[model samples]
Target: MVQQRTADRDGTQQKANHTPWLEWVASGIGLLLTLGIFGSIGWQAFDDAGAPPAIAVDVTRVVPVEGGYRVEFRARNSTGSTASQVEIEGKLAGDGAEAEIGHVVFDYIPGHSERKGGMFFTREPRQESLALRALGFADP
Candidate 1:
């Protein structure tokens, strides 16, 4: 009976040693996966760091509203960084004369995204030469 108890004790000791090895392997794999995920994210951020902010303005539509003409436009940001305080200026010209001026401001424009806004002008923009330009932007 004593020999049988000793054999059982040896088996239990072996199982205890093997269980820790499995636990260590699992912990190592989890740590490696975590590090790999973070490393890839950091690499992508560094890769996009050099891209400059490029903001563009496109007038989509112009409709006459109650008080003025609503100039629907799209603002596109083709950069890696976010832009803040984005301002767009619009001018309506007819026969070499500026008829009206309007402007719109966007609070935030994220990188690789587009935002829509409108400007109001007293004159009908369809009859005149409408010029839309990006005034300025600040880094967010």
Candidate 2:
């Protein structure tokens, strides 16, 4: 009987293809890794610190009293953390406004609260101006 033989170099056996699925699998994994990296950076940039903090601002009212409007606000910090600083700003609403109120700052510890006062106006601001509406907290 006669025997059949396959071709070989130097009369030795041939080697099979190694890592055939490596290229495809590696490409898919690389794509997923890039997407994950970008997603994490975007989420971090959008996250806010004082947003879910322990302090919050509560504006009670803006009434025309005591010769001018009295703006009352309450600061409550109950998230077990203290607010380092809080600021409040206001401006008169009218045409060609000249009066601009600056921000008011306060500090509070955890579980403690404070009330903001002396947000007074020298004269009655126009009710129709946008600035007036903003100071009145009517839009927000």
Candidate 3:
């Protein structure tokens, strides 16, 4: 915004002034917007930080592959915190056959979120004896 306007002696514009009306308004809006976003994020992080990750793993599906069985599983984190390097272990034991163990590692599971991965096993898993559980995890 121009605060002053002057005309030259020859009837041409010679002086112009800029007022920071728009600049101040824009800066205020930007500052408020940034504060709102960062404030919410900070509050959320503070609330969730004290909680630990509660994770569980379950076998969703088991299908036969060429050389082994593909066991698809789902890992869920039900707490307010996240888990990293989550280990899921699977055990398959059928009557008279030896127990076959398989494991899969999930990269990360966010709080109250789920992730899917697959493990390979030489023996097919039965629903009655198939065991799927969260072995361990690192805090993220």
- RMSD (CA, Å), each prediction: 4.9, 14.5, 5.4
Backbone clash tally for model 3? 0
Candidate 2, residue 48: Cα displacement in angstroms equals: 15
If scored against the real structure, what TM-score would every candidate get? 0.65, 0.38, 0.69
lDDT for model 1 comes to: 0.85
Residue range 1-140, candidate 3, lDDT tens digits: 13333334324423235446898899999999999999987987887766888888877888999998899989999887889999888888878878888878888998879999988888767788788899889976
- Return whichever of 1 and 2 wins on lDDT: 1
- What range of 10 consecutive residues in model 2 has the weakest lDDT sum? 131-140
Between candidates 1 and 3, name the one with more favorable TM-score: 3
Runs of candidate 3 exceeding 4 Å displacement: 1-5, 8-36
* Model 1 misplaced stretches (Cα beyond 4 Å): 1-44
Candidate 1 per-residue C-alpha lDDT over 27-57 given as tens digits, one digit per residue, 9 for 90 to 100: 9999999999999879869877567678999
Displacement of the residue 49 alpha carbon in candidate 1, Å: 3.3
TM-score of candidate 2 relative to the true fold: 0.38
Q: What is the C-alpha lDDT of each candidate?
A: 0.85, 0.52, 0.83
Among all candidates shown, the one with the greatest TM-score: 3
Model 1 misses residue 43 by how many Å?
Answer: 6.2
Better of 2 and 3 by TM-score: 3
